[model samples]
Target: MLDYLFAALLGVIEGITEWLPISSTGHLILADEFIHMSTSDAFKEMFDVVIQFGAILAVVVIFWSKLWPFRINRDACGSGVSGLVDRYCRKDVWDMWFHVLVAIVPSAVIGLPLDDWMTEHLHNPPVVSAMLILYGVFFLLMESTVGKRRPQVRRIGQINYRMALFIGLFQFLALVPGTSRSGATILGAMLIGCSRTVAAEFTFFLAVPTMAGASLVKVVKFLADGGGFSGSEVGILLTGCAVAFAVSMLCIRFLMNYVKKHNFKVFGWYRIGLGALVLAYFYLLKPAL
Candidate 1:
């Protein structure tokens, strides 16, 4: 019962933080310091990544029309497979997906090789705190300078292959704990002349594949290591995912609306404050205790 309750709480955290410029993984890591579950370390590690599957599903649901690259057509071009293909193929959507694929390459190439090393070494309070503060400053600086200019890329459709690849390269920075993948890509996009709305939308779209692939990898690695879920673990995982899905729906909607008129300055300040608190707790307060 207690485990389920904790899972729900973590789910709430994930749903809220995942969409925001705030780091969901960083928040989860910090939350774990206090909300220790009955699960093993391996299960907990896997749970953090897998729980994001729910959040990904939320994006898919909200952007179904935009993400789905197909359409129904009553008029036929041919009799069989060719007709079906002609009816369903959406060239624009397919092109957007190709851009997304190109953007993910830099991260996949770099992240895959360093996943284990980063998990073992960088997944800790000190590293998370440092990144939280560092990126918070980056956000502030970008907004003060670049935020003042008229953006060159104001629509999602305007984002071309070169821009997507540039954003993806920045995403590689997010491999470090607390860097926040969305934050990095959105910031990078903004720096490269994308409007706030366009940057946020593309970031949300980019997350679908990136996070789904990550969750799959985590699950595979867990099973490969002989980590099987007991009944309770399964229940806990589902509970967390369901809650995350529900909360993510609300959060994503809120973010899309919020970015239209506002900048990310508030989130930057919040990150800096949270990073300070984490550092003080782990290095100063906790050690004294």
Candidate 2:
């Protein structure tokens, strides 16, 4: 009962924090530490990967129209038409699709090999603290230097393959525990001249493929390793997924509107403060471990 309850709590946290520039993995690690939710290695690993699916589904549900526009099949036109019937084909949407592919390739290539080793051995509280602080500093600097938001690249459609590739390279940094995938990717886009709103939205879209693929890969590996989930365990899993999806829907709606009027400096400050607090709690407040 306790484990199930904790899993639900963690899932809600993941959904709410995952899309934000804040580091969801970092928060998860911290929550586990504070709550003492210990588990077998296989189950622990599986929980981390599976919970992410909830967040990924939220993006798919929210952006279905943009991702898969209603395009009528021209070949279905049989009324003696010389050419294919007109459909909702936008050259820009196709181009954006191509760019998203370009952006996903780099992280997929680099992250697959390192994921197990990092999650198994390198997931530590001190590392999370350092990452939170370091990325917090980067966010602060990025917001100050790139204060002049550009208007040319307003939407994902405007992003070129080269920019996508650049963002992919930056995303590899997020393989570190504390550096957030969204945070790293957004900074990459902003550095390459994408506006804040564009960078944030692209991060949300890129996550659909990137996170889904990663989660699926992990689940496959866990099952291949002969790990079994009980009936009650499956119930807990579903509960977490549903909670995460519900929270993420609300978060996406608010963040899209919020960034239009403000910058990420507020998040940066929050990260710094949270990081420092984590350090103090573990090092000064608590007794030696």
Candidate 3:
């Protein structure tokens, strides 16, 4: 019961933070300091990474129409969950996927090399705090300047290869903890002339592949290392994933509606305050581990 409860709590955190441009990994790391799972350190580490699979699935299901590569056959056009459509030969959708592929390359190239190095040195509260504050400032600055001007590209389809590559370059910054992946891409996209909705939607689309592939790699590596788990541990992992999926669907919908009406400044202020709190808790209130 305790393990299931903890799993559900972690899932709630993941669901709320996952799509909010608010650094879900950073939030989870901080939460783990308080809510230790009844599992091995190895399992806990893998749990945090793999739990993202559930969140990614939310994006896949919620945005299936936009993400599906097929246009419905004229004969098959109907209603809910149109499955009778052509599943292939979607040139426009394929082009969008190509752009998404390009946008993930820089992070894949850079992150693969630095993974161990970052894990060794930068996976601490101090580093996370600094990044949170840094990106908070970045968002506020961008909104004050670039956001006031009318964007050149107001829709995701208007994004070109060069812009996608630039967004990918920005995503490379998210290799650092606390530098939220969606935050980086959204800010990059907005600066490059994507409207608020366009930036957020593109980030959502971009996450489907980037995070799913990442979760798969982590699981594969864990298995390759001869890692094994108890039945109870497996239950905890499943509980977390299932809860996260349910919560993420709600969050993704809320964010989509919220962005259509407001800017991201509230998130910026929240990051700044949270970063300060994390720094203070570690440096002044708590003793070092």
Candidate 4:
């Protein structure tokens, strides 16, 4: 029962930080430091990665109309494969998914080799702290330079594959804990000339595949390592997933609406503050506490 409660708390943390450009990994790590769930270290690590399935599913459910790929308006003009394509999938939507596929390739290629190494070496509070501060600085610097000027790509439709690939390259930076995948992609889109909302929406679309695949891989590895869950552990995981999905729905809606009128510098500042706090907890307060 205590584990179930802790899992719910973690789920709320995951859902809120997961999409807010504040690194979910950083917050989750920090939370675990204090919350102290009675799970093995290995289970906790795998739990953090696999629970992202819930958050990404929120994105999929919210954006189903845009992401369904099979949904199309009926229009009869052409009389061939083009017509069938139009009837089944809108050309631009197909193109958007194609671009998303292209964008994920860089991370997929680079992350595969480094994932094991990073899990072995860099998964720690200090590393997460450094990345949080680093990306926070990036957001502040970017906002200062760009200053919400009229954007070249105001709509997702305006983003070409070239731009998508550029954003994906930026996303590769998120392999570092606390870099925030959405944060990197949003910054990249802005750098390459996308408006705030457009950048964010594209990031949402990008997360579906990226996170889903990542979660699946984590599950596979955990199983291969002969990781087994007791009834309580399984219950905890399910509770976390369900709570994460619910919280993510609200978080996504709030962020989408918030960006229409504001930028992410607030989240940037929040990350910096959280990073500093994490450092303080580990260094200044650990001895006393």
The number of the candidate with the highest lDDT is 1
Best candidate, TM-score-wise? 1
Candidate 4 lDDT (Cα, 0 to 1):
0.87
Candidate 1 regions with alpha-carbon error over 4 angstroms = 74-86
Which stretch of 10 consecutive residues in model 2 shows the poorest summed lDDT? 78-87
**Each model's Cα RMSD:** 3.0, 3.8, 2.2, 3.9
Deviating ranges (above 4 Å) for candidate 3:
74-88
Please give, for residues 1-289, the per-residue lDDT of candidate 2 as tens digits.
8877888898888987898888998998888776645456677767876888898888888987677645655477666455453566766667777888899887788778888888877688788888888888888998888756555677777788899999999888888887899999999999988888889888988898888888888789888998878887787778788888889999988898998898888888888898999899899877655
**Tens-digit lDDT track for model 3 on 1-289?**
7878999899999988888988988898899789976687778878888888889889999988788887777666565464466765777678889999999999899886787687678778998899889999988999899989988997678998999999999988887889898999999999999998999889989988898878877777788888887899889999999999999999999999998889899999999999999998998889754
Instruction: Please report the TM-score between candidate 4 and the true structure.
Output: 0.92
Model 2: runs farther than 4 Å from truth? Answer: 37-39, 69-90, 149-151
- Which pairs clash (backbone N, Cα, C closer than 3 Å) in model 2? none
- Which of candidates 1 and 2 reaches a greater TM-score? 1
Model 4 ranges with Cα > 4 A deviation: 72-87
TM-score of each: 0.95, 0.90, 0.94, 0.92
Candidate 4: tens digits of C-alpha lDDT, residues 1-289: 7878989999999999888999887788778777888898778888888788889889989988788777543355444343333445566788889989988988999987799898778779999999999999999998888745778998888888889889999888888888898899999999988988989999999998898888888888888998888898888898999999999999999999999888889988988998899899899999687
Pairs clashing in candidate 3? none
